[model samples]
Target: MSDHAVSGVPGGPVRESRDVADLMRWFGDAWVLPLLVGGTSLVIGILLIVWPNVTVTAVAVLFGVYLLIYGVFRLIESFAADEAGGTARVLLALLGVLSIVVGVLCLRNILQTVVLLALLLGLFWLVGGIIQVVAAILQRSRPHRGLTMVSGVLAVLAGVVVLSYPGISLLVLTVFLGIWLVVYGVLMILGAFRLRAAGRRSVEVTGGAAAAPAG
Candidate 1:
């Protein structure tokens, strides 16, 4: 059984063709989700960095919330992307699930040890980054593929750094994570603009198709 999810206009027929821009048209903005994801990430990243007297428990809670929010968005993107291949969708879905699970674990403080928390966050970023890279690669036709790939690579590096020095102090870890988030958030914002451009192209294609004479 295939796990493919088709895209289309809300309250309308599902389109088998990946080229259909129903969502883009009906939603009045194809790039909305990306913008939301980027915007939120950027905000949270900034908060984590500049906030005074940030404690371990606060960091854990904030990080957990970010994870849950990001996971939900990723899951939505995975299923709603008709243009994405099944494998890509699956990878994204897995990332979402992993993120959510990690978020829950963080919030619940299931692992009381500081080391364990570091390990968990590191693993999440590591796996999620790899999945993003792979999915970006597989999505050959997507706009801003390079941007996405860059984002993934940054994530992977951040993860590696965290894992390599799991014993790092709160100040060091907080600053590092903040820096990564800011950069990644900027890239995602750029990617969202690129997606907007793609949406415009989709509109043109759809218009041309509609204008074609019937056989």
Candidate 2:
């Protein structure tokens, strides 16, 4: 429900930007982190909003895939969270495990999996938002710290709302899920570009791109 890049390659910045998802590496291909997560989230969000009639099985599969991708990236992000030190890294790692667990929960009947997700999504987002806030706090001087913190707060609010209304109708839940993914994806994509720019700046000054952000 919530999450948070740079590129290294030949060609002008124009061509380089297209390497948005060349690989999932965090340091050299730092851009991959957000782009992959953001791109997938955006696609899922669009599907949920525009294709409400889509089969539950299809949505469940896609959701599972998203969780797997998110888990992998988050696990790596935990390692890259240098500024936040060990505590933040550990929390991110645990969150990654949780994501993976839910993804693997796909083995259950499709309907059951979907219902479980609907119920668990709030807790997932709540924990993720808390981790984000903590990471931002630790890296007090990071660019956009205030905005990041605010977004984390928003995530917490969204989680609380969803949790408070567990019996929210399917249509309402779908809309909620769609809107959440869209906003989260847009923020991640924007952050990716910011990272790309920062990487360019680093390359100019120190002959290398900036490292990935802390989780």
Number of the predicted model whose lDDT against the real structure is largest: 1
Where is the poorest 10-residue window by lDDT in model 1?
A: 1-10
Residue ranges of candidate 1 with Cα displaced over 4 Å: 1-28, 111-113, 212-215
Give lDDT: candidate 2, residue 151: 63
Cα deviation of 78, candidate 2, in Å: 1.5
- 3: Cα error in model 2, Å: 47
**Candidate 2's residue-wise lDDT over 1-215, tens digit each?**
22211222346442443443232123435766878898998999898899776555666667678888888987987787676678777877886887787776643464554456566677777877887788668755344456557767877888898888877666677778778888877777776676666555545543233233334
